[model samples]
Target chain A: MPAAEGTAPLAVILDQAGLDGLLTAIRAKGWRTIGPRVADDAVIYDEIETVADLPMGVGDEQKGGYYRLKARGDQALFGYTSGAQGWKRVLYPPRQKLFSAKRTASGFTIDPMAQPDAPLALIGVRACEMAAINVQAKVFGDKDFADPGYQGRLKGALIVAVECTRAGDTCFCDSMGTGPEVGTGYDIKLVEMVGKAGVTYVATAATDKGAKLLKAAKGKPAAEADLAAAAKAVKAAAKQSRKMETATSAKLKDVPEHARWDQVAARCMTCGNCTMVCPTCFCTTVEDVTDLKGDHAERWRKWDSCFTVDFSYIHGGAIRTEVRSRYRQWITHKLSTWHDQFGQAGCVGCGRCITWCPVGIDITEEVAAIHDSTKGRK
Target chain B: MAERKRPKLAVWKFSSCDGCQLSLLDCEDELLALTEEVRISYFLEATRKIEKGPYDVSLVEGSITTPHDVKAIREVRRQSKALITIGACATAGGIQALRNFKSVKEFIRCVYAHPEYIDTLTTSTAISDHVSVDFELRGCPISKHQLLEVLNAYLNGRKPNVPRHSECIECKANGIVCRMVAAGTPCLGPVTQAGCGSLCTGKDRGCFGCFGPMETPNTAALAAHLKELGCSGRDVQRLFRSYNANAEAFRKESETHG
Candidate 1:
């Protein structure tokens, strides 16, 4: 046990012993702890109940069109970056049974799905992921059309945000001003310093829930040295990130119609991988599923990408049939038009689109190309 | 002596992806309530139940691309008291309008093995060209809220409070830092109408003009800006000839550049 904070906050060092102890403690709290664990060949976000479940001494290597897990020199439980799956799967499940209906003599009786009763403790959340959650909150929790399912899942959930110490080649959260260090929108933020001095975890509470959690944990008070080390870690991560300049909350009207989109469209595949991986992309399509008996029908809404030809199809035919138009729609809406609708730039610069894209399409490169092309004309 | 009546509502399809109609169904919570307010007399996408018209309101989707479509819309016009065209297809010819520049024959041959089976008009034109449209709800897929607003306005006997302003005004109100100035990203928000809630820009991307051109859009100035941004003449042409390629403002702009 390390020196305690004013009270006994959790004092485990997150080493082999601490990892086991922390997992045991979390389970003892009667809460489900979700963290990064190895599944198949890649590290995926999943449920973890033991130290063995953690991806120790592993870090993700990500770049434009590349993502892989690599070995680290030291064993650190929360050393890895984010993976293909996000905490969103836990909160806003991809496929949800909204409401089931059964046919009656007069009409149908509809039954909405029951809300999640169990509370969740998300461990190893990155700052960018936290921002993504914040964005979803506005759409699902803060609005008049509040998603009941999202509300129920997020109501009492605890978020343990781990400040990113390593920036992937595709990472550009700094450009979107969402990360490098854990900003707002987390319960507890932790910065890990791994070196010859073993590993020191500097933790701070961002919300009352986090404060309460810290109070429950038996840990030492974080000193000024610890804070400085955390700051240094954030600075290094910020420096490591590839620069991507973006306009925050910029409107579409400011941009003049130019040839830049066509240039980007030249290479765009219209596969919609960018939108699928995008944390903020919220376009959806409704599907009507009728029972085989044809007595009752159910309507389901699923995520839809603007890249699909059918997405823009009108009565006569599909609008934006060409790859160029689809790419143009996707990028412009994200950077420019989204400001008009949501009062913010759609991109948080997670660089997931850049990394996940099969053809390695880089948004930063496209923007630069457009900027360079028009350099003299303006 | 019996109280006669709910307002009759008809949903007609032309040449669209059925996304706009799906927008109506997406209003899961509101759909049952909406039915109580107005009788859904002829929505094939929702129910096979069809009633003879002189429909109180007819919501039309898609564009007039074939001779049959042209005749069918005329019959719909005769049967409806109010006609509202939803989505880019009905209001501005949508993405299919891309073929307006190229030869329709060549396009058919390139895309389909059985080109002869495809009986399509040379150009996809908006419903407004053939028949009078009471109002036009614009978008690649019409915003559900806007769709509700239009329906409510019609029901309440009020003018729909749809903004005619460009996406720029919305961006400023939303406090979005301009993508063009900050990131040097090429965008079409300036000329595009306000709707879809600045969605593309909010994601740190440029606008693709899915909502179509706003009233009195300065397409020439926008084109000039695009030219300044190093967009080629062909690029400028392609930009105007997108979702709303057949819309007059965008069409003229594309022609000017081409």
Candidate 2:
């Protein structure tokens, strides 16, 4: 339906063809589209071209130490709860070459790595992931230590967030106050409601750029009925089965020596998978590579994890020698001290850490175990 | 150009496949330039030219399996300024180290027509077990990049920039999916050293751990998870007892299983 009189529509209803048109419009704005795709038996985020590239009929199951992709029976584009990998792989990048140095007769000649030519257009982003992006933005783009590569990628990027209508077993974003519904920071907000309309999507423009792009899609103005249905769907998602006590975020640092840490550390592989999959874990280390002939040298910045023994390295040896201390540092900093440091808890509750861990050590369980044991004790 | 005398490099082999030694030759493009950086004095694989003792850097490959190998390693230690062991065999004990669990006498009787003709040690041991090693490069065949780094670091009088962390770090750094986590495959990446660029996992296979145990590896923790991931006790044991079988952490963990 068209908008009433001369007023522009606040929301639009996008069908199959309209979705494709939206992707085209995003491309027209000179942004490379990236979204979830069914690869390696998991819905991992990669460069996507058409609507066919999306995980349309796929559903994902995630638990502590477990993640599996299954057929959703019906064609629901946003059926999956969370992604195997987060957005950091694109924004901050996994491994980035900082600079390359070559030995000249006069002095050393150094060249910095080039910036990306085109900006990114992230499609099908979840609400929790939006929060994760914001958290990482703060981490990388802070005044004292601004990462140009990260800030540049984020600054020129367009975000299309999809409000989740289903909560996975590992999801606890409702309690974290970050998800199930799109909060601030999204450019375009889409609520995927698979109802009587059959795989319907309510597209609401969150920014002026989003409004101009939505108009290009030529989708119908969203009726009042479609808007209400979308609201009901998000309300269902808000019924989070797995709840992490927000209060636990404040006291996690207090119980550093808690017995629960040893128990959790027993199962923790310390493989650093948790930090790898976490969208907010932004620690990095640099390595210098030289041609064996020693003529040229290149330095690379790689994502480092707190779980590794080398993460706490000094002159003599690593401080966190034991897995227990490393585990304590990761969880403590993620839930508690992060709030003190960044004014927001590090965990966005996407639960990628829980799903991608080889041994399935649940972070929420560890936090709750300590939270319960330390209850009412001043 | 300043007339700086090049350092002497000696490549020695012991009792195993020449795969690790081949890794040096495998630096096909860099090999020629490497010769310019150092004098190819004592490499039997590339050059039959054997130079005198007191070499600048010695790259020793293979395990010390026999009495002759044990004595030779000590002599190599005395001659070389820096002795860097290469591959699983020299650093741990190669696949041949599997014999460390069994009797060498029985094996000789099974393989050889005359058991009396064979003169072999009961166990295959690392170069470090015999003499002082400045460094040890891990892998069934060392990573070509790491080999160059070691050569570059020691030759330039600085510590090698080889990371002693788990393979998981490398896998994540390269955006390789966790085969063990995503597909429920049994992997040794959590316990194995960071090298080989997470080669196996990048190919959608679990890490067989060509690189030996990482520094401060908790093998027992990995073993438990491997078992939970549908690896049987013997399966878990055999997994740890593969290329780097006789490495201390892998050896101890394997012994705990069947």
Candidate 3:
């Protein structure tokens, strides 16, 4: 099961001890590595220095509007799916000050805040989030008005994605064709499988840089059985995952006039939580601020939501005034019009919207309702 | 005219706690620079120097719980070119509006040594109830960024960009896991206005509706959902009766459940 003489190693089997070396290798490359950690009763993405810092032996309970971290006995890392925090915050910060101005003797002098330039190595990224990041890259990296900050962050980072061995209750990435397996958009992809022997990570280098790091980390060249196990693990995860109606994404645009919009709107709070948790949701509002003396002023950009009445405001009033209309706008924009605008679906089906929703409003359920109610009518 | 003078900005307080006014002061990073932009004519929380009438923009906090407050707000509104209400107390009737649901005389008798000494209105009403307001920044204590936005908008002759969406939007944007679904906790986030940066939800708890109800909130649906989540009618009632209990939307919702 060794690699052919001239062929490069496609996969490597890393024992439990090699995780430390992997962390060391990432840090040795002068990258600030961050991954999932158990904090505040949930798995949160944070800075990790060692393997122990990872949410080892932790599994998450996720449902529509619910989340909790529990011990799963086996000391398996990357067992949990998406948490409250995503890589988007690390890439495009929640609150970013664009520029600061000062009152000079002549006039005001504006100074753009220096963007953080350090290379970040994001560990434990799920496949769904990879798709989310791709969607975000399209939005923020739009040719016309690309966010320099986002571009810089994207350019300076390395993505270390993790294949899901098990999916969360709210996850529908399988149906979305986004996850449970690692395909692309990552430097390295790790699949941790706990076997009868012990925990071993089936690592695949997606880039040359990732390959060098894997070699430096000193994991054994993966056997054929190890590769099979990893693929089997991903398949099992895909089978176990809660799925959405895949056809709904394509049919979403055609059913805007469906009565289900009203029914879903009744339950939709127009809180925009779904958009907020959505990794691809990049709406932002800018605010101008002046100090007490009015001499120095600064403009800041913070996250905004489509659900806000003022988001679609004009001179007379807001366009989407009704809550139902706003909800309709959000769902349509996310599922249907997003393809028209961004050339891709806005949702990655990570289920953050469902898991973070206060009333447990499920996007997949809403879309399914629309699809089902208007199956052949139109 | 010699040179166009700088517009005067004033911050006024009334019946409630000074938290909202303090929010303006909490803009410590921008406070010194803000003074350079507008004259701080009257802000008792930061400075005691009282400026004369006819201020360009007045930021008023608190509710009209006393007859004195009602008259004072009218005078303040009359004197200011643009009067913007800051916080739940100034827009919605604040936490003290629970008094609106009970007998003022009985409450005065119960809390005070002598009911005769107390001179109070039966209801605590927002400034808008008595006088027209240019804008209202809703929150238990308005966000500093939002307060700055309002002041900036007023100064620039534009509308403030503060949102009227519910807390669920903020919670979602923050990527904070939903406590209601995960823990069976009842959250007011769905119907409550956006602000507070999803603080409660980020801290692993349900939103207590500190920002009040969003415009045209469907409380009936939320109430039914809360019931399905094991929140009884009384629990739903109590949830809506939190910070902005007397705010029209929340008040009606609370009454429906009660």
Candidate 4:
């Protein structure tokens, strides 16, 4: 439950020591707390048991087709940009068994598999990732035939968002109007500031649950100076971000006809890496598995990508036969057609597609190329 | 009238490392259950019991390298209702296709003491190149999961839902960091098919394109990107000429660099 929309939001200040209590509060409510941890030279989201598991004093450098972990002198957890993994994996798993069937004397008896339905409390979620999750909600939470698996995990979930204090080389969430600041869609919004005094966190409660947790944690009301510092950190992040112009997204419909796709196709492996790393990508293919006895069979739904040739397969042949066409479909759908289907852009400007692409093809640059070529062609 | 009979299945091998056939035995948990549904009529690797076919499904492993193998494969196709080729060796000539570039006589002389005793074709080719194939599973060693899916699909009389995408998709779905981006390593995952479960990437190495090129792969684009990553023209050529070198997409890409 959240306070009335017009009411003033409650704010509190917590030092490094108070972070432990915040984790305790979330855990005390019987919620699985997930946060960032250092693994594979990048920040990965996983179950966090204690503060020590967090990637403290760690910063990451991310560019188009580049990522490296850098150690910062000051201990600052949640200091890096979003990594390869996101909250989507927790909600919509990579692979899930839909149901299993056993051969009966007559035909077959099908048994639906039970989905993992534990309540989750996500900590240190970036604003861009929040937008991705929100976008995915529309894809999976459709009224006609919503995905029960995603819905089950989403129910009673808590989001503890963290505003960005720094931006990566590929980041453009500011231009996407999705990040660098946390305005909504969160239970508690935390802004961490590392200063000469010490590392401090400014937290604002947007919901009753968040407010109760903030009150229970050992913390004082945030001073005006502390609030100013938090705002400055976020402002700096926004200023540093290498942004993609959102206006280009409007003209993305003409991208398929552009010659740039062929040029991109030459350098593109059609690897589907970008689609896989994209938090909002929700395409999937079903697989049927049977035991040698043929008595037992199971249907599994695994995460799928549009970059595959089979992804567009029709009765006769593939619809999108060229690698260039597949790339065009992917980028266009993310930027323009998604608006037609979901009423919101598919991309959140988190730049995962740029960072994780095997060849370092930047989506922002592709959009710019399309915009430049399609100019006045209408 | 004959009693309700189980479908007879046969496994055949040609010129390969026997790794793909091992993938069948690797399904240890399902082996017993599988035998109950389909009779293992002619798998020489597993059992001595050989039942002559009119096999319901025939699983072929390895490429057609020798002149004798060419005749053997046609007869096998005649006996099989559905013929499926498994692994790079069967689907795209395997690493042996490297001979397609060089002289077979020179290779035989270099490797064997008696070149006169050796009998091999100048080129190693896919089974489909010689005979009609119902399905082809791609991989250096076809995934066990995929093999099972293919069998299940054929048994149900439906198309197998095998993904024809690059390894980049699997790496991302599994939450793996791109080795090329993070380490400046050149990877062929962009053009290689998805089936190997991102094996090399999981081990912190770039994909070596063991599964060959995905459908309509943009090899020229990937080659140019590889060049930018400091991979020389020869390096790019060698990369494409590995396991599935004779594959149409990879063969064309490698030839461009060569």
Query: Which candidate achieves the best lDDT against the true structure?
Result: 2
Candidate 4 structure quality by residue, lDDT tens digits, A305-351: 78777788799977987878888888889988998889888988888
Candidate 2 residue-wise lDDT, A1-378, digit = tens: 233457754699998778889999999879999998888888888899888899988998888778888899887887998877889999888888889998888879897667676999999889889999999999887759898889999999999999898899899898888987877777788888776557867998867788889989998999898898888888888776677776975678877778887887787878888999898999998878777656788888988888877789899988998889998999889989998999989998888888788778888777777778878888
Off by over 4 Å in 3: A1-6, A101-115, A142-145, A293-295, B1-13, B19-52, B109-118, B142-161, B171-177, B197-205
Q: In model 4, what is the error at residue A291, expressed in angstroms?
A: 3.6
Ranking by DockQ, best first?
A: 2, 4, 3, 1
Docking class of 2: medium
lDDT of 3 by residue, B1-258 (tens): 122357898889998799999988898987876786789999887887988988998999999998899789989988999999998898888989999998989888889987788889999988999999988899988899888877776665666766677777666556665677566778888788887888888888888998888866878878998998888899999999978999998899899886
Task: Compose the digit string of candidate 3's lDDT tens values, residues A216-317.
Answer: 889888888888878888887776446677667565767657787777777777767777777888889887766444566778898888777778889898
Q: Which stretches of model 2 miss by more than 4 angstroms?
A: A1-9, B1-3
Q: Ten consecutive residues with minimal summed lDDT in candidate 3 chain B?
A: B1-10
lDDT of 4 at A121: 89
For model 2, what is the error of residue B9's alpha carbon versus the real structure, in angstroms, after optimal superposition?
Answer: 0.9
True C-alpha contacts between chains kept, each model in order? 0.00, 0.59, 0.66, 0.76
* Model 1, runs deviating above 4 Å: A1-16, A248-257, A314-316, A376-378, B1-258
Candidate 1, lDDT over the whole model = 0.74
Q: State how far residue B212 of model 3 sits from its true place (Å).
A: 1.9
DockQ, each predicted model? 0.02, 0.63, 0.50, 0.55
Segments of candidate 4 deviating more than 4 angstroms: A5-8, A112-115, A142-145, A254-256, A374-378, B1-4
Instruction: Give the range where candidate 4 chain B is weakest over 10 consecutive residues by summed lDDT.
Output: B1-10
